[model samples]
Target: MYTTLLHQYQLTLSSRNALFDYCETVKPEDLLKPLATINNESMASLLLHVANCYVFWLANSVMQEKHAYFKGDEHLDLTAVRNVYGQVDLLMNEFLNHFKDSLDVPLLITRPDGSQLTRSPFEIFTHAITHEFHHKGQVVNMSRQLGYTPVDTDVVRE
Candidate 1:
């Protein structure tokens, strides 16, 4: 379980990096192109949200044992959002290095509604990565709909 979870996290990181690279090649003006008529978030917004979610899960939830990261009025911008992704990625790598030998250590987590749950550090890591993948798929579809080339990020299909 530990090894499999670690591998998944690694793959998620690679996929995310690939997606970001592909997005970076896109014209800045193109990022704001309307992709959908209803419930549409720009490509930039989607990318920013993914990064924010990761940082929130890592800093507020996993590391500090606080509630979810965002409150009501958290100021978010593209540069800050991108920085969060890089920060969380580095933090996760450092964490895995330190805890690889003791992957069974239980992590105490506090839910949004003030509930408590216990899970292995591996499990929390797994959740974070999978969550990013889910959002990335949405961004990909939106990109295609907007006539942008979606990032080829599928681990198996790429």
Candidate 2:
């Protein structure tokens, strides 16, 4: 189970990098363009949300086992958004590396509604990666609608 979890984590990390690279290639101007039909958020907004989610989950949920994800207002700065993403990526990598030898240890996570559950650290790691992928799909679709070619972020190919 530990080996399988580690492999999943590695694959997820690769997939995340692929998605980030794809996002980075998008033009800065197009990132803020509004969608015509759907009231979808701008690419920059989505990216910012993703970064913020990562930080909140890592700091409060994963590391501290606290239920609440974030406690702040939305950020609208592109450079700050990028920096947040970079920092979360580095922190996630560091955490994974540190726990590589303790994959079997379970983590206790508390819910915002006051529920408690236990999961392996590997499972929490996988959840974080997959959560990002779920949101990255939205960004990819938004990128396509904004007249940009979205990079192929298929996990199997990466």
Candidate 3:
């Protein structure tokens, strides 16, 4: 199961890189341009949000680490975006390795609102990746709305 999950994550990274490649062609100002249609979030913000979610859930909540969240203003360029994801890749590796023997063990997590829930590492991993994809779709739509053509950003692109 660990090997399977690792393979899937690598595939996810490939798709994510495709998105990054598209982003590299966009001007920095455009990446930071706010779209009222998408709740005033710029493409950079959305990307940062996706990275933050992974850090929050996997690093903070699951691993009990206190890594700081990536900020949008600080990571507006493609280089910064790639650096942010480099951190995410490291975090993902640490997570998968730490839980290799206990992916299904339920662990208690506290919400920001002070509430709590028990979730297994497998469940958290699933939630994080799916949430990323959901916003990845939003990123594509936002790009289209911004007058840029969207590219294939799927795990299994044709």
Highest TM-score against the true fold, candidate: 3
Instruction: For residues 16-135, write the lDDT of model 2, one tens digit per residue.
Output: 678767767777677776676446567676666666666655566667733333222344445556566667767676666766787568878776677888877677776777777887
- Residues 1-158 of candidate 3 have per-residue lDDT tens digits of 89999998999899999999988877788888889999999888999999999999999998989999997778878799889999999999999999999999999999878899999999999999999899999888988888999889998887
Q: State each model's C-alpha RMSD to the native.
A: 3.8, 4.0, 0.9
Model 3 alpha-carbon miss at residue 42, Å: 0.5
Model 3, C-alpha of 127: deviation from truth (Å): 0.6
The C-alpha TM-scores of every prediction are 0.72, 0.69, 0.97
Q: What TM-score does model 1 achieve against the real structure?
A: 0.72
Estimate every model's Cα lDDT from 0 to 1.
0.67, 0.67, 0.92
- For 1-158, candidate 1 gives per-residue lDDT tens digits of 55675687778878877777777766666665546652666666666666666666665666763434432123243455466566667767765675677667887878668998887767767677777788788777776776777757977654
Clashes of 2: 0
With a 3 Å backbone cut-off (N, CA, C), the pairs that clash in candidate 2 are none
